[model samples]
Target: MFHQITVAFMLLIVRALAHDSPGGQVVLTSDETTTQESTLHVVQEELKEAEIIPTVIDDFLPKFILNVEWSSSNYASLGNLLKVKRLQSEPRITLREASDSSASLCASNMTYIVTMTDPDAPSRDNPKWSEMCHFIVTGLTLSSTSEEASSKVHFTDLQAIIPYKPPGPPPKTGKHRYVLLAFAPANGTTDPLHVSKPEDRQHWGTGKEGHGVRDWAKANGLKPVAANFFYAKNKKQ
Candidate 1:
């Protein structure tokens, strides 16, 4: 009976996500004490429906909830479309445990790395430069404390190895998927870590097929913990 209810509830979530306005604001409403795991599944389904899972990374199992706030009120909500101008600046990121939202996940001592990529670089149908590395930031640390439970804790010191480049899809290229992935030291090994920049944005320096986030993460001994993404296109197109 519980399984049946979960399935039913999930259907409602899917409908809500499907209907959310493209330009609508994404607000974090729940208290810090609990990050809803059900929401996590909703995000997972969004990725699958949008083909972000197979197109970029092969699979994803989120250990914690990743919240990305683009502006004061705008947050990354699944595959919602947004104007290119609104995403020019770097967005803030926060990670919270899925099991207990109140329980903060990032520790002061731990380091995290983030990567933003565009899998549908020129166009989804013909992606010669598939999986373009939009940006990469390392040396991120937890910057907030428990006292700010009402508010989310954001990662600090965004040291971008590959500086942020805003989405600029060519006119009439159709919509592009901008994916952000968060990684931590695999197996809790917290040594000073470094990620090599791709040879070029195109094919991630591997090939036309691309080296991709999964390959890069595995090579660096980092584990993908959480992810979020959005869609954008040249408004003129």
Candidate 2:
């Protein structure tokens, strides 16, 4: 039932992460305190009705490890970095500081292809299951030490088939979930377009294999090596 609680919060965090600037993780603030509180109240009521004991957001999902660091924000762990008032600017990543989390260092040769998706479209309650992918970086390499600055052994910027595009959810409609997943492509860049830089990332079509995380992982014969997410709220709402 703990997993169910996590799922419920994930449903709440439907607006989780979109994009973080290359500079680092950034935070977005919102003033919808009443709405936010009301949403939490609803979640609590649902939990009580189900006889479920809800825990803090930290227990909702597994945190991520990048170069021996755990993924986090000023507020809490992964999936806990809530609220992006505006869907544009990249959020600053807080990987370099994971002193409190149980983080594991990675092997030098390990690499992953990261992708983030927006599940509900036009708006959260609307149709268009084909989610809008917000960020896709291929060939991200992990190094033993933070000093290693080579792009090849770093976050795999050059292998970006699609550049980072901040998610801009349609006004109103409701909140949406943005999940980030990291995978090890078994085919080793099967698509011809999986180059250093694709012509575009903003206008790419939504489908299963091309940019979908689970679809891509299924097609590539691997699961997500790492995953992280956060939610955001629209200003108009």
Candidate 3:
């Protein structure tokens, strides 16, 4: 009876060992499984971060200012001129010279304006519309003859027009283009126009009185000699 009991006990031990193994290999401990899961999660997070794209400032600059122009489409008249306002994302207008000058410096008190127009915008009768352009300008001064200053105004402080009402919705199935133009006086600081009201001037992102760059440029003597273009893509098919 004692020998029989010993054999049964040995068989039980072998069964338990086999159960703890998988595919003839020893099973991993709980801690080891947890560590492997954590490592995989970390690797996934790193891959996601690597896929993100970074936005660069120089990418926005136009290759040639001469390529800028106004749209010849009816969408220009869709919104009331008095009620038209600039987009929130694009707040400032700036101007830069084609060639650099040693004496020239970007300075504060510089003013700019931006305009968006879609010439190929589809009409009510036409279904297909061509792409449009967006513009931005920097490096404007008060007058043509004013001495160059080191501190220059950025697009943030540039003058713009913001209306009481929001801009009309974009057309269906068509991409809208806006042209941003930055202008400076050929001479310097002859007449400075205040584009914002006292209350409206304080807010940066809001559509305050001085919020539209295009409106501010029009109020001032700045001309649209140079410009950049951007096209808004269509999300729907």
Candidate 4:
């Protein structure tokens, strides 16, 4: 099944990260409403056995809220309007390559890619069957042979895709905005990495726990920078 494949892929990626030369840390957390104590405990034990530190954020906290705020005037009852929601919340992408820093992705270095996805969508408020996004972050520096080539990307991998629906009597024309973010060490930075292929976004939101680029960066002592608005287009292959 698709779910199994996604979970397997996520596990493989995490395992790879644990074995990385400079071995990085991974933290998995759940929203307050969900009791993730047992799950977190298991993950911690596993990480410890593997010599990786794991952190969890289960207490209901404002900093962990993941929703968009619309204008007060435009905000109607939750049941009435089509609102934006996160399909994949917190998928982490790990890149491994032979570079000393983040500046060498373009220098003929091959990077390993890891990503996650969230498929949950809003209810009947909108007529669309599903609305989701994919995010990918690579870990090229971790795998690089050059000590100077091991810098992380300054941003997270982000891609949004919405299915098309027939307009009723009046065809409405408007735009929806999605955000792509990146996080890196304070002194570390890089120009925006451009994704020109649809396949790049397809690997997102496929993990047991949703992945967020910001969370991944923070766990790894990095800062996050987000791109405010991204427009999705309809293209035929």
Candidate 5:
């Protein structure tokens, strides 16, 4: 498997360094350190490219699993890294149990609000414009099907308060995480929500840090139900 190979490669690198040095004290020139760093970077990128890292538990917290699939056949499973072009269109979303996709959660007969946001607006290191709202759809509901289809939801059938904005990470800004969240009506209230778009994408229009889906959901009496996310970077980068 790719993961096994990556781990083996990393071990080999470490062993090589230890073997080359005396008494386990490895000394390297400036160029050697740069080369090692580059190699390590490649390993990290390969892990992401292989969709072996960045799980929902690792990236987004206090969240459940939501199945998000785009027309391009790319799925946002466990924070898999995807190309920006592949995510240009809105993805079909389905709410599922946090631990089981086949088993449905308590989302039946509930109207949901779906939202997408970028927690790393500029870059992970510097996210001054963090939590940028990318998409928001209200009046989303489950399809008219059997119990097995309880996870299915109608995304395109409703209107978006904040239209979908494709991921366009600036060149060399590292990878940005785009998270999709589904919120159900709070306190067993199923009335269609009259939500409005944020004044701006930055910080969900709060004009400050620490403002995003959680804040918006609290203000509108929406409860977090299920969520999913993906990573995207500029092609030029």
Candidate 6:
């Protein structure tokens, strides 16, 4: 009877977690996949020990629907995962020319607007420089000249909204959230969005009033499609 109950409980748990997709119909993240696999493995072990009829273990496997990764000259940060978790130590991004290298995005005919920011400078409470723009690109497509290969890795012809500038978290300030956001024209048109990069907004993006990410996206009918971010702490050097 105990064995039967134990087996029933295990089956219930496995069934509970057996959804078509993780995180409620959107997609399964890397960490989410790891957690699911770990749980499933445990359930399988429990079933084996319980002497219960073993079911197909692959029945609970999560399918990968989408994957996107962003990398720069300084640090390689995988999509959805925070930066501080990946890097050994905070890099002095200001001194180095950290341009973007490659991204494993969905192969599609789509334009993208990439924006990076530091939302922690001058401390989190009294953030004087929130969202310090690091890099911004626009008009990226599959056949774009920016990509080295006609490899269909999801980006091609592109424009730079804000040229690449490495992370510069000020000294004495707390860690900064370096966020890279990609937006697609909400209108879904292929027309070139000839937007001139704003000036004096390099640090914290306070240079131009009302011309920020939200404003520009509204004006150009842009919708955020993808994003990645990491944290960089204050480096005295």
Clashing pairs in 1: 33-102, 35-101
Task: Give per-residue CA lDDT, model 3, range 179-230, as digits (tens).
Answer: 3344554344435544433123211223432233433444454544333333
- Compose the digit string of candidate 5's lDDT tens values, residues 169-217: 9898988877777777667665557775688988998888746777787
Least lDDT summed over 10 consecutive residues: which range in candidate 1?
25-34
Residue-by-residue lDDT tens digits, candidate 4, 130-235: 2234444443233232332333233333232222121111123232223322233443434333332222222222232333333444444443321112222222
Ranking by lDDT: 1, 5, 6, 2, 3, 4
Instruction: For residues 1-237, write the lDDT of model 2, one tens digit per residue.
Output: 875575465434433321342222322211333233323333333323322212111112222332211223232123333445443444332222122231342434445566666655455455354356566666565432253333223233336555556656666856555555555544443342242332233223533322344444454464444444445556686
- TM-score ranking from best to worst? 1, 5, 2, 6, 3, 4
lDDT of 5 at 3: 60
In candidate 3 the C-alpha lDDT for residue 44 amounts to 26
TM-score against native, each model: 0.82, 0.50, 0.33, 0.22, 0.65, 0.50
Best by lDDT: 1
Residue 31, model 4: lDDT of 33
Each model's backbone clash number? 2, 16, 34, 38, 0, 6
Candidate 2, residue 234: lDDT: 64
Per-residue CA lDDT of model 1 for 116-207, tens digit only, reads 88888788887777878888888765434352344543333567777777889988999999898888887665576777887777666677
Candidate 6 lDDT score at position 9: 61
Lowest lDDT sum, 10 consecutive residues, model 4, at 59-68
- Cα deviation of 146, candidate 5, in Å: 6.2
> How much is the lDDT of residue 194 in candidate 1?
73
Better of 2 and 3 by lDDT: 2
Deviation in Å, model 3, residue 101 alpha carbon: 9.0
